[model samples]
Target: MKTNEEKKALVKQQYSELALSADELKGKCCCGTKPMSPAKKVFTIMSEDYSKLKGYEADADLGVGCGLPTEYAGIKEGDTVIDLGSGAGNDCFIARAETGESGRIIGIDFSPQMIERARKNATKRGYTNVVFIEGDIEEMPVPDNTADVVVSNCVLNLLPEKDKIFNEIYRVLKHGGHFCISDVVLNGMFPKEFTDNASMYAGCIASAIQKEDYLSEIKKANFEDIKIERTKTVVIPDDVLKEHLDEETIEKYKKGNVGIYSITVTGKRP
Candidate 1:
């Protein structure tokens, strides 16, 4: 088994490559990373539609998000918002629409390639208030009590030590400040091979924990008034399953109690 640092490095490397080719490959990728064979196109099962949202930028949309956290974020004008794993600034630009010109949006991402691409996108749009910083979410370089709100999209499950990450989120927000995050969670077990695959881990499937555990971590971070805003059952295509499991196992998995869900949850630091 890989160590925590090794897993982090693998995730970082995958995302770095994704930052370069996501736009060009478009629908060919799954969960924003893990490029499939060109002959077999992999549809994105995690991303929500962002094309119709206000302040939507086509170049900024990498088709990686599992849900639209901004839709349920309850952001107000002039509020400072921090987006964790803000890839290419998709959610940042959308939050900017709600926060308006007076508000500040800080996007923290560990991938330098993603940070550079996000900065370029911001510059292209002439947005001075939206800034992308390269840093680990588990140990953010931001100051305490620095944000009015926090938002993340399908990025937390990719990292180990989710408890530490949630604690960091709590530390960054002002008292009574809230957070909305969209992430993936599992309802049942997966085959050992599925969990062992590096590509599957970065694709946001194998790494996902139980839904109950995900919520427990949020509460453990001292967040209050936690609620699940939305939940959708994610259907992984059979072809994708074929990459990991044989026909018999796939058939059993399809008939079994297994379920993958994309959930958007909200909580506050109090």
Candidate 2:
């Protein structure tokens, strides 16, 4: 087994590579040499629904999301949308369709590779109204009060400075702009050792904020109308679970100490 520091380093390095090469990262997931079956199933369902709309690409890219923000955000034909941590433009593309030809979508990510992939996908699909930028969400490069809706998919938990992220999101949104996202949340406190594990952090499990703490942070950022739209227990796939976690860790996960959750949290800027 790797040391704690070593695990963290490895996870950071792996995600850096993933941000640069998502196809390669997909190969390394629990499913092996293909998209994780569960992820593929989810993506396929979303792609089919999105395809019905004009100018939408059913086969946009990897399906890397824990929640559906477009549905929850009530995206309309002329609304402006921003997607934080838009991996390979999946959510951005979907939002673009919902916004229609009159609407616009901006997707931002820190990973150059992800940005490149998103750009290429946008070009291939000929989506003139959609754009993706390479930048950090914690310090968004967009102008303040420019977006009508801001959404992210399972990406907030990966940040080291989450408060700044929320603040930035608040700053950019128009008054009464919407904030909707799907991310993991911890049910209880984790052991210090597990909490500090870098691998777990990047894997979207270890870095998750407690459920109550997450809601409180949103309120602290001056958001209102907070709601948890959906909650489902996420079962760690056997393959990836065995590779990173021990029996104790596995048991903890099985007991609902750690699980995948998809919540549609909606708040408006005051």
Candidate 3:
């Protein structure tokens, strides 16, 4: 198994390279699911209504998120929002509209290439308040008690040290500040059949623990009013599973062994 630092480096390299093209990214990422793939059905349950919101830049969304955390983030004008793992500034742009001209936004991602692309997109739309920075979410460059709100989507599940990320969120948020993030969580850990698959880890499968555990950690970090805003069972297609496991292993997995869910959860710093 790769160490945490190694995993972070690999994630950075992969996402940075994927930043080169949206078309290629959609087809190549997440256990190799293609556009119109059955795997996409997982998003239909609680998908983001991007049309209802405004300030979207072209090519900003590569459709990487499983749920739209920004949809329930409750951002207001003049609020300072921090977007963790903000890719291509998709959620950041949405948050920008809620924050309005008087507000500010800081989008932090470990991928330098993603930061470059996000900055370029922000500049294209003449967005002066949004700033994309290359930084680790677990150890952000942001100041303590600074952010009014924090948001992320589909990115937190990829991190190996989630407690650190949440702790950072707790520390950076103002006393009344809160976070709403979307991520994949499991009913149980994967069996050996899936745990050994590196591609699954990169696809946000192998890394997830139980949903209860996920919530408990957030509460442990001193976040209050924790609640799941939305949920969807991400059903992996038979065709997609065929790429990773044999028929026998797949059949065994079908017998109520594991369940993967995409959740948008909200919490407040008390």
Q: TM-score per candidate, in order?
A: 0.93, 0.81, 0.89
- Locate the minimum summed-lDDT window of 10 residues in model 1: 36-45
* Model 2 misplaced stretches (Cα beyond 4 Å): 1-13, 19-21, 24-59, 251-260
Deviating ranges (above 4 Å) for candidate 1:
27-43, 248-252
Candidate 1 similarity to native, TM-score: 0.93
Which candidate number has the best lDDT? 1
Relative to the true structure, candidate 1 has a C-alpha RMSD (angstroms) of 3.3
Candidate 1: lDDT of 150?
A: 97
> Per-residue lDDT of 48-117 in model 2, one digit per residue for the tens?
1344544445344454566666678888889999999886787887787788889989999876767877
* Clash pairs (backbone) in predicted model 1: none
| Candidate number with the higher TM-score (1 or 2) | 1
C-alpha lDDT values of all predictions: 0.88, 0.71, 0.81
lDDT of 1 by residue, 116-216 (tens): 99999999989999999999999999999999999999899999889999999999999989999999999988766677777778888778899999999
Error of 1 at 134 (Å): 0.3
Q: Is candidate 2 or candidate 3 better by lDDT?
A: 3
Q: Look at candidate 1 and tell me the lDDT of residue 69.
A: 95
**Which rank order by lDDT, best down to worst?**
1, 3, 2
Model 3: runs farther than 4 Å from truth?
23-49
TM-score head-to-head 2 vs 3, winner: 3
